[model samples]
Target chain A: MADEVKLFRTWSSPFALRIVWALKLKGIEFETIFEDLANKSSLLLQNNPVHKKVPVLVHNGKSVCESFVILEYIDETWTNGLPLLPKDPYERAEARFWAKFSDEKLWLSARGILFGVETEQAEARLQAIQNLQYLEEQLKGRKFFAGETIGFLDLAVGWMANLLSVLEEITGYVLIEEVKFPLLWKWMQDFSDVPVINESWPSRDKLVIKFQTMRDSYLAGKI
Target chain B: MADEVKLFRTWSSPFALRIVWALKLKGIEFETIFEDLANKSSLLLQNNPVHKKVPVLVHNGKSVCESFVILEYIDETWTNGLPLLPKDPYERAEARFWAKFSDEKLWLSARGILFGVETEQAEARLQAIQNLQYLEEQLKGRKFFAGETIGFLDLAVGWMANLLSVLEEITGYVLIEEVKFPLLWKWMQDFSDVPVINESWPSRDKLVIKFQTMRDSYLAGKI
Candidate 1:
């Protein structure tokens, strides 16, 4: 039987975009079911009861939740494309490590800068910059986090290329100055230049407005 | 060159124990270098500069830092073993999701209960139990999380079998009662019964003393 791929996602989620980019990169056809996260569909609720989050990939009736997990699934299931992860065990571990680091540490630090209380923003910004420095070091002498090609780590950290800028604009906090994180700044440009990624991002204007409203809500203690 | 596997770990850490269980499960010969976490060896600091935590597996000269990442490394490098992750992409995704869920959500909830401030303990206990209920449901018909054999998810959550009880004892809050979570409770027994797992665990008495001191330090605002 031919594979039937469907993605449950919101329009603006970077997590969902990771799967979209992976599918596009792999040249796989998929149905994108845009979800209103405020009122999530029963399909998403059923597929991802634990998190009830977006970027749930349903393939051949089996559902894969979690973006990184879905990315690995997409790579494993669609072997015709350039491999997302390296074949060597050590290299694969390194990729997975950075991918996880990007999501958990770097992303969380960015979130702190975005949503933290006014008193805490300065400390949070410093933490985010420190985390960004790690990414800067990782990108040294490499085009992407995965090297030469845009691969798993690139997709994992891709949000920083665009969404982070929107966040910086909304919060008036410039965490990734070119002077501060030169390689990472270059990486942002390199990541956004990828045809699949460049073509797939949501409108920057829409994201800025969306994040600005969300940041306001966060500051008001409504979220 | 012959494969060289060395594990940097603290004897009492559940995270370190996960790597220990994985290596032993594969019947792979490895050198164990015990780290005094308070006064960590330069080898460990150099190997895992990011976290500077234990369960750093250095195979040949390359080091894999995170425990879950290390588990995958072990599975991929040692192909002769009964697979840590399932062969099917879908099953592998499911295992990864649950493994992540265990480490991030369930484990953090347990931590909140263990070290959270006095006023937060009640709420944290409820959250931990809610997370445990999710695990109970996942274990409905299965003997282990990966079915008849203990695999990735099993090792990911194996800490609950031993260390959770220590936390409960130290904090005086029982999170896992057989009547409340019969299946998860049984799965814990089954997980601990595995010879390698049973043999490798730190002394329960020592753990209680260690955790009690840690918990006191936490409540005393020293940690």
Candidate 2:
């Protein structure tokens, strides 16, 4: 493996997990370096100075930061493997839109539930419900964000598989329950069942514990 | 000019503005089709059913959504023009990194400041200042986000030129003044002065009144 790939990542980071999933799907074996968020390395800062966050893919000593960008780089650099983006120009643009949508729409829905000191818990619930409603409407007749197979949106939103539980655990609410958001519920089950994804995902229990710690710290004015 | 390119855009949207800059820089004459957000056309919905957002570039009947994705499509289709993205693989990847940096980092900063509720105004300012500090560090000695010339990053963050005044008019906070964010302040000047950008920009007075009306409407509980 002379052309080995290396990554600087964080275990609970959805961004980092997305990269891990891509690497696994491609069957590319690479070395992983996990950084403790509380005590990050100088190298991580150097690699991603603007954001200084995780999931930096260093391919052949060159670094590509940002998870989605890393995904595109991964696709472009490797010509033969499973292509994450589509071949059609419009289709590729559509994939990128959903990937962007996953963050802008879904995260707001989830984050509205997760953080906020002044907003009523009921308002957060209402916000989260509205978000899920919109998502459910979008997923009404589609198997995935794209037509058939999992594409960028799946990777973009797949973090919900791990982090949704953390929000539920903290707030004592289940936003993705089968009764309320059946499409999202069903999609999660199918997405996680993908063989590569099933094998590559980090421990759910560990992520919950980590999210709890972060929440506790935020509440205690420690973050 | 039957085969002229077409653009679906709004005045305030940075993403759409990016397409304008690219097309203008390349000396391509395009028919601008402005979309009314309040009453979106069936065509806009059909073109980008996923996001239902603007800056959708229609070339020869096919549409491309998302500014970064559209930039790529423009580069690929208009191969003979002044390149927005670099040609080399490594350099291209890095250009993408910064472009993603604009979307991932700078955008959040611009958004929170522009759209945050009144009580969250302070937090929005904090995010803006933090983002500017990060940019200063990233662009420490480098002339532009892309070393020598105005590249993708410049276009990516160019919306701040239109957005700065709107945020100021709405919140009465000046984040991009000459003394406070000198580099970024100069950046606005540098970005706006290019003949292509200067000629293609939305009238600042029109944009100010639009933001004022929008802000008044938001305060009046219409939005």
Candidate 3:
């Protein structure tokens, strides 16, 4: 098709990294344009006028916004590659369900613990632990959330492997501890072992400094 | 492989209607179980342990939660009748982008106007109007959001046709007026004329009564 694939992304964005991992896993070559979210570029604005967020995958001049939507687009377009989702309709639906859960519940609950006010932080910690417990039960006897090998569900939840540790450093609130969620804790370890993911994940120290400053500003009411 | 199709839905839920319309559009026969959300059935709790919400499409045995996800699943599972999404990748992404916007932005904005407190209602009205303006622009040259047919984006935004009018009667605010959003006003008329949609849509009078009571409860701080 000769489509010039380009990705508009920002550093330290877990959403953007999901696309990066998807493209890498599918062996697609794409040009990455780092956008300054503080002062968003004209390209990002034109591509995603609605959200004005990053991780816009531009293929042949058309852009696909939203992380999970982009992953579906990639998988569909590059049908020749290792399938991101399972072939069975039921299994595919389950994978989509978990991917959405990872976005709506897992990410939001974790955010509450990291930067929420005092009461919010307490409630969020309880909810986060509850969500993780459910996930741990689902992960029983499975190597990954997707099972057997890394795929859509694995990529969707993979942010937990890196971001959870970074948040622990920034907020001193430990999650994925072996005592509470042994299965998910092990799953995180197995998720990171994949070469593409291990090589491309952001540095923990860098993320810590960034999130620490962000949390401080949030508490100070500067942002 | 004769697969049995079943849908767990609530009569008053616009979300569940989306799945209903989707199945009817594809000519797929299914059984509907009306759920009492106040006292949820064990089937709903067991199938959708996470959200416990309705519009869970159970095909054969597995259930798919989330209305938009269920629509995609139905489209993929039954590849007959009419296609929900366009075949082109870019067009499909655009369809998904709008479908998500209908959820994240439009629904919340409309809710803000309908049920928000004094100050919130004013702000929500402005946001809701602005969102309608954007959609109006998108619909300037198109009969439907998905072009000539009632497809994914149409189902996603169909709530505006029924719910918007109900909210207007409850709150005395008129949206999608011909003067303000001419294209959307016309699109609303065009959308309802579709035999499948018109036949299955809930009666406006009944919905008005339901929402009026609900809004009173909300304003009285009883909800």
Candidate 4:
């Protein structure tokens, strides 16, 4: 039986976009079901009842939720073209660790800078910058996070290549100065140049408007 | 050279204990270096500079940090033992998902019950119980999380078998009533009855005393 793959996603969610990049990179033909996160489709809720979030991959009647989990599923199931995770056990663990760090530490701290209160934004920005420095150190002399080509860690932090600038523009937080994080700056340019990634990114102008409104709501205590 | 395996752990930590259980279940010989979390050892700090936390498995002089990441590392590297994760791609994704849910949602909410302020305990307890309900439902007819044998998800949530009761005693909030979570209650009994888990648990009396002091500090605003 041929594989039937469908992804539940929002255009602007980096988590959802990770799945898109992975699938496209692997040359997998999958259907995309864009979700209105505000009024989520029943299909999404049914597939992912636990988190009720997007980036759920429905394949051959089974659904996999969570972007990281979905990414692993794609790599393991589609075993052709590009492997998302590395082949060696140790390298695989390192990829998982950095992917996790990207989400739990880097993204969480960065999100704080985007949405945190005025008094907390400075502290959040500092922590986010520190977290970015860790990535900079990791990227020292490497072409991409996975090295030579886009892999799990590259797709994991791919959002930063585009959305980060949008965040900085809205919040006036100078997060990724080239002088401070030269390697990361280079990585951003390199990551954005990947054909699959470049083609898959949401419109930057639209993302800026969307995030600007959300940040406004967060600052005004409306959401 | 023989695989030099060493696990950095703390006896009272559920996260660390998961590694101990994984190593023992795999029948791998290893050394254990207990860390004084208050004044962490340089080895622990150096090995896991990112998190500076325990449950680091150093195999052949290379270190893997993060309990979940380490668990995967052990399963992949050792291939001989009882498989920690399922062989199927979809099932593996499910195991990863629940393991994540166990930590991010279930344990986080339960920790709030143990350490959250008095005014917030009720809400935290409610959220923890709700999270447990999800686990209970997952265990409806299965002997263990992986069906017949103890697997990744079992080890992921193995802490509740011992520590939940201690937290309940410390906070005066009953989380797992037998009537409310009968399946979970049975899983707890079955999980504790496993030989490795049964033998490896810290003394209940010591845990009670330790948590009581920690809770006192939390209540007193000292920690």
Candidate 4: TM-score, chain B only: 0.96
lDDT of 1 by residue, A1-223 (tens): 8889999999999999999999999999999999999899999999898999998999988899999999999999898988999899888998899889888888888888778867687888887887787878888889888889999999998888898888878778887888888888888898888899999999999998887887788778854
* All candidates: TM-score: 0.94, 0.75, 0.95, 0.96
Q: On a 0 to 100 scale, what is the lDDT of residue A93 in model 1?
A: 93
| Greater-TM-score candidate between 1 and 2 | 1
TM-score of chain B of 1: 0.96
Candidate 1 docking quality: incorrect, acceptable, medium or high: high
Give all candidates' CA lDDT scores: 0.89, 0.77, 0.88, 0.91
CAPRI verdict on model 2?
acceptable
Tell me, what's the RMSD of every candidate? Answer: 2.1, 5.2, 2.0, 1.8
In the range B72-187, model 2's lDDT, one tens digit per residue, is 77776777778787766666777777667667666776666666676576786787788777666556666666666677777887777767776787678888778877777777
Tens digit per residue, CA lDDT, model 3, B145-173: 98988889999998888789889988888
Whole-model lDDT, candidate 3? 0.88
Q: What is the lDDT, from 0 to 100, of the residue B21 in candidate 2?
A: 86
| Residue pairs clashing, model 2 | none
Q: By the DockQ metric, which is better: model 2 or model 4? A: 4
Write candidate 1's Cα lDDT for B1-223 as tens digits.
8889899998798998999999988999899999998899999999999989988999998899999999999999999977899999988998899889988888888888878877788888888998998889889789999999989999999999998888888888888889999998899888888899899989999998888887788878844
**By the TM-score metric, which is better: model 3 or model 4?**
4
Task: Tell the DockQ for candidate 2.
Answer: 0.48
Q: 1 or 2, which is superior by DockQ? A: 1
User: What TM-score does model 2 achieve against the real structure?
Assistant: 0.75
